[model samples]
Structures are given as C-alpha cells and as structure tokens.
Target: MKLPHPIQYQGSKRNLASQILQYFPLDIETLIEPFAGSAAISVAAAYNNYANKFIINDLNKPLLNLLELIIEHPNKISNNYEKIWNKQHINSVEHYFEIREKFNKSKDSSLFLYLMARCAKGAVRYNKSGEFNQSPDKRRKGTIPERMKKNIMGVSSLLKGKVKFKSEDYRLLINDISEKDLLYMDPPYQGVCSNRDSRYYSGIDHSEFVVFLEELNNKNISYIISYDGRLGDKKYGEPMPKHLNLEHIEINAGRSSQATLLGKKDITYESLYLSKALQKRIINDNQNTLIMKELKYA
Candidate 1:
C-alpha cells in the first residue's frame, strides 16, 4: 500500500521512506519519531508489517494539531478543507495572504492545514515574528479536492489505532524510548538551512542534541538519524558526535527541491546515521545493501 504524504515538509524524507526503513531492524515493537515533521517516516512505517505502535512528536504545535485533527476527525478536516479548497480564490496570492493573516490571528488548525496544501513549493515558511510568510505556488493548480480527500482518508485509516501524536520537544520524548523501540530522528540540519528555515519551526540546539545522542549512545539505544548530508558539490548538514562511532548510510535523494527553488542544478544527497547497535543488526540480517562505505552517494 502506498500512502502519499499529506503535506510537503522541507527536509522531509517522504520520497526516501522506503529506503530509510530498510535500514531499521525488523523487530521493532514501537517506532518513534522525535522530530516528526510531516511524520513521513512514521506514516510510511505504519503500512509496513514490522512495527505496530508509532509515536510522532514535534515541537511545532500548529502542525501537530493539524495532524491530530486528521487522526481523530478525518471527516471534519476533510469537510473543512473542501470548503476552502473548492471555492474560487480569484487572486490566489491575495487569497493565500488573507488565509495567512487569519491563521496567524486565529491559529486555526484547519486554516493552517489549508495553507500548507496551497503554499509555494509546498514549503512552509514564517517570518521572525512567527507569522506564516510562504507565498502561493504560481505554477501548478493545487491538488483537487477529490484527490485531497482520498489521501486524507487513506492516511487517516493507515494511522488510526496505531499512531499517537504528541506536541513536545525532542529531548523530552527521548526518555520515553525503550530498547524495544526504534527511534527515527530527522532533526533540523545544523548549518545554513537550519538558520534560514528556523523561522518556520523551532531550531535545534546542535550542542544539546549532540549531548542527547551521547546519552542514547551510552545506553546502546538503536536509532536512525537523518542529519547533515550533501547537495551536489557543496555539502550541507552536520556530522555525528566526535566520540560516537556509528555507521553512516547516504541515500540518493534525487535533486533537491530547495535547490531547485534556489535555481541551482545539483543532485541532493541525504545521510542516515544509524546507531552502532542497529548497524550491526542490519549487517547481520544482510540488509545493508546501501552502506556508505562500499557505494558512493549517487
């Protein structure tokens, strides 16, 4: 079963979820995403036979609230979304700004979701004052209501009883993870993108995150982290802690949408840092076909 991501999230691994899941251990009783932007990995994992319980936690309240609405009241969200989507917004940009203003003032979950669906490049942006600032995509017509409804229903069904959504900082979620759980963390990148995109959501404190990883490492917890990788010739992202020994697998992510937006013509690559424990398990299971050590990032 294929499930489309309900929203387009910057630095999302929605396209690469299958490939990323291949690196996870087959016996995960619980799957958790601490920085669950789009919760793409968890959503994708829900369809897989491996994990039964899923935890999706993020500090972004508005996004998490929208996700919760979908999980609990798919029909409600669908109905509200259709009202906004099916109507004619004569000037799409002006209509988008109008919705943005309402969303900023009201913090309405339904309106926020609508904005996400219609925003430029499906990218969510905000100004320093914490207002939605992304412009409308001028090139293509937004997804039709029929398709949107189908996706909403499908994703909601996929996530129904198995998934739990939490609005919390990544650090607090860390304590909830157990040895039987597989943690998939797609934290914000450390460099330029983090600084530029921090306005959209809270930025990660790299130093604190590294310290947390060390704590997890000391406990021998298994995880797969999507952090700093490469974009064409120029590399962007952060590396693992200096003292941590982990296996790094680079996934070929095709062209970067962000790069395309910036008018650059370079292939993008993503790095998946697996805890040593998980790496050993994958190797033992003979599922390490794309190990970065043997193959170049294509």
Candidate 2:
C-alpha cells in the first residue's frame, strides 16, 4: 500500500518502512518513535495494523506540532496550508522566506508545513539560534493543495485517536517505555549529524547514545534502530558496539540519487539494529508460521 506522508522529510524512512517492518512482531501494544521525523514509521505501522497505539516524539517542537495538526485537525491545517500556498503564486521565493520568518517568530505549525513543502530538497536546516534556514526549491512550487489535503486527511483518519504526540528529549521519553511497547529509533546519524550538524537544533553525543542503548538492554526493552550505513565504499557513521549484542542488518536503500546524477552507480545501504529480545520474538513468530503452514498442508 502507498502510505500517506503529509510532509517530505530528507531522511524519512517512509520508502523503507515496509522492509524495516518485516521484523516487527504481529502484535504490538504500542509503537514508540523517539525521533519521529514525519512519523513515517508510525504511519506505516498504523496503516499495516502492526501496532495498537503509537507515541510519536521529537525534539523539534515545530515539526511535532505540524504532525499533531495533521493527525488531529486535518481540515484546519489543510485550509491554512492552502491559504499560505496560494499566496506564493505572485513571488514564490519571497513568500517562502516570509513564511520562514513568520514560522521562526510564531513557531506556527501551519507556516512550518508550508516552509517544509517549499524548502530545497525538503532538507531541515537550522542556524546556531535554531532558525529554519533552508532555501526554497526554485525548480518547482510545493505540493498542490489537493494532494496535500488528501495526504493530511488520510493520516488523520488512520491515526487521530490512536496516537499521542510529544515534544521532548528522547531520554526522558524512553524512561516510560514498558516491555509491551516496541520502540523504533531513527536518531541523528552519528558522524553526519550527531555533532551539532546544521540539520538539527542540537546533536546527541555518540557515547551518550551508546549508554542509552545499554540502559534499554538492561531494562529488556525491544527496539529497532535505523542508525547508520554506507554509500558505496564510504561509510557514514560508527558501527554499534558489539557489546550491545543487537542484531545488525544492512538494508539496500537502492541507488543514491546524488550518485546517479554524478554518473556513479553507488547503492546506499542503511543499517538496522534489532534488540536481542525482538530478534528472539521474530524467530519464534517465523517458526510458528512455518508450523501452521505444514499443518494446513497435512
């Protein structure tokens, strides 16, 4: 199924959601996303009925608020978006920067959505003072109002009552996670964005993140992390420590668009790390499936 995504995020797992979800158990009480950019995984999980409830959290307050509006008050957000999008007809670039200035001051979710749609490459970049500074994509205007409405409404219908929105540090959120809940983490890439990359307002320390993973293991919580990977021979981030005992899988994310444009056939592979407990559950689920198939044949 083509999942609905109201926003275009640069590193969104929307395209890779199905492949990542293959490891999810058939039953999940809650699916928590600590770094829920666009909440792509949560949206996919809800679409596939893989989780009964969802907790979507992000440190980016404006982005999280935009998501909340998309999931709870679709009509209001869609209408506001249309108004903003329509104004750009006269001078799209000027209108985009105007919206960006307003968003930085007001932090209005609707304005944030408009800027996200019109931003160059859908890349979220912030200055030292935490301002949205990405330039507009002059090649084309943002998504049309009709398509935006459809996507916003589709996401709202799927997750309105089933989701809880949060704007908090991931560390604070993880403390409340229970064994029944499954956590899917797509944290800032260690090397690329972990050290205060302009893409984020702030960056997580690699050592601190490792310690956080250790704590999760101690609590026996199940998690799936989309941490790091490579493009051709060049790797992006440091590998997860072996001591964590997480099962690592590399997903082929297909050819890199940048590489293709450069006339290089470099395939981008993303790293997926699964907690040991989750891995064991997946193995058991597969065995049961095979057993059921054999019995039916007999």
Candidate 3:
C-alpha cells in the first residue's frame, strides 16, 4: 500500500487542493508558490507524489526557521516536542508567562512547537524584540499525540529533497518563474487583519500585492491569485482587464471565536475569491510597464 499523504499545516487548504489542482496540469515542469504560508501547497503537491520542481517562498523569518529545523533535524525537534508536551501546567496566567519567557529565550523548533501547541488560540505573536508573546491555552488541556516525534520525523522523510523552500519578499520572486510554471500565491489577507492590532500579520501592504500581481501578469506566468472580497472599506473596487478570465469562490470562514483566541463565536466565514486576469494591453507609442489592474479590496 502507498504511504498516506500528510497534511502539513495547522490550517491547511487540503480540501481546496483538489479544486486548485485543477488549475495545474499534471505534466507541468515547475510549481512557483511565492507566498507559501504554512507550506500547505508545497506539502499537498509533494504528498500527491509530484516531482521535486517545487519552489516555495515566504517573507516570515521565524516560520521559515522552524521549517528548516523540521527539514534538517526532525528527530531532535520531535523529541523536544514530546518532552515538552508531557509536562503538566497549572491553569494560571503566571505559568503561561513563565513558559512564554522560556520560548522567547530559545530559537529551536522544539520550543517553536511547544509555543504553537500551548499558546493561547495558537496565534504566533512576537514583541518588537522578536520574542514569543502569545499566552498559554488555559481553557483547554493539550493532548500530545502518541509517537508525535516519529510522526514529525516523517514530515522530513516525506519531503526528502523534493521541495525547495525560500525565505524572501514575494515581490522579488517573479524572477523565479517562467512560462508554463504553475504559481499558487497565497499572500496575507488584505484587510481583515489590518483593523486589529492583535493580528500577527504585519508589514503586508495591499498596494504592494497589487504591484506583485501586475509583475506576474507582464511575465505571462500562469498563476492563481487568492484574496479577500470583503474589503475593509466598502469604497474599495478593482478593474480586471476584460481579456483575462475572472472567477469567484465562496467558502465560509466559520465562527471567528471558535477559530481564534477571543472566541466570540463569530459566524462569519472567510470566502476566498480566486481570479485569473490576463488581458491584451493596447500600446499607442511610448510604454514603460503596462499596468493591467489596481487591487482595490474591502
């Protein structure tokens, strides 16, 4: 029997992978994922027994650092998680703070796993000093999976030199793609996290994302761009070229409270709208960079 494919993300789009896979041809030579948050796409493609022509990139340093540990020293990190997971903690804010302090002092994947597992609501937050500031999950007790160490070790074994991970600003990744390359770009949500300072996704400017999309369009690279339709401002609007195809996808984001630390039990589901806009630009005379679209999100 074939080995069962592992879903390597805390909140992965494995369910949507099948639909997204439709955008990709089976015989494609390369997969270009510029914003590989949590490596959902990379892990999914690798699990499907694809070739090693996957190039994944992200700007976040800590997240990539953890993945490096998972790739290089999975056993030690898994052992670290098992050791940390076995300990019991009292339901006190003070105990949470103590663990948080320790997590900040260490930079290994073991501490990363422990913090992610035990942190309140599993939000990875850091202070200006780059310290792990998320509190402990006091409401629920953690149940460490049996043989979790081995399972994590299995993540590295599964990857096995088939995936190439990169840490860089996605805007600079256009050079990495060519014609016929399948690029699945999952950038940070435009506005939902902007209004609240509690969100960990910082420094992602929506305007920059629009520019990035334009670059990809100019290069004639095949790609599927995912973004939020519920813009923070109702005044927001976008104009996709009449030539490129446009499509909408609606998926419930679900109750926010159940999905986050503040657990207000919000029923709002985040609907992801994917678009493929490619249009012919009419150039009369002088031309610099042909701008096809300006992203206007709510």
| Residues 1-298 of candidate 2: C-alpha lDDT, one tens digit per residue | 3679989889899999999999898767899999998999999999999986999999898889899999999999999999999999899999899899999999999999988899999998998788889999999899999999999999998899888888887888767788778999998888744355788766777788889899899888889999999999999888999999999999999999999999999999999999987887788889999999999999
In model 2, what lDDT does residue 256 have? 92
Residue 42 lDDT, candidate 2, scale 0-100? 94
Could you tell me the TM-score of candidate 3?
0.71
Of 2 and 3, the candidate ahead on lDDT is 2
lDDT score, candidate 2, position 19: 97
Model 1 agreement with the true structure over 93-150: per-residue lDDT tens digits: 7777788899999899888888888887788887877778888887754777777778
- Cα RMSD of all models vs. native, in order, equals 5.5, 1.3, 9.8
Weakest ten-residue segment in model 1 by summed lDDT: 191-200
| Residue pair clashes in candidate 1 | 228-237, 228-238
The digit string of per-residue lDDT tens for model 3 on 90-206 reads 544564565567756765555666667667665666676656667677775443645455555556776656567788877777777776567776665656334533334345676
Residue-level error in angstroms, candidate 3, position 15: 4.9
lDDT values for all models: 0.80, 0.90, 0.57
Instruction: Give the TM-score ranking, best first.
Output: 2, 1, 3
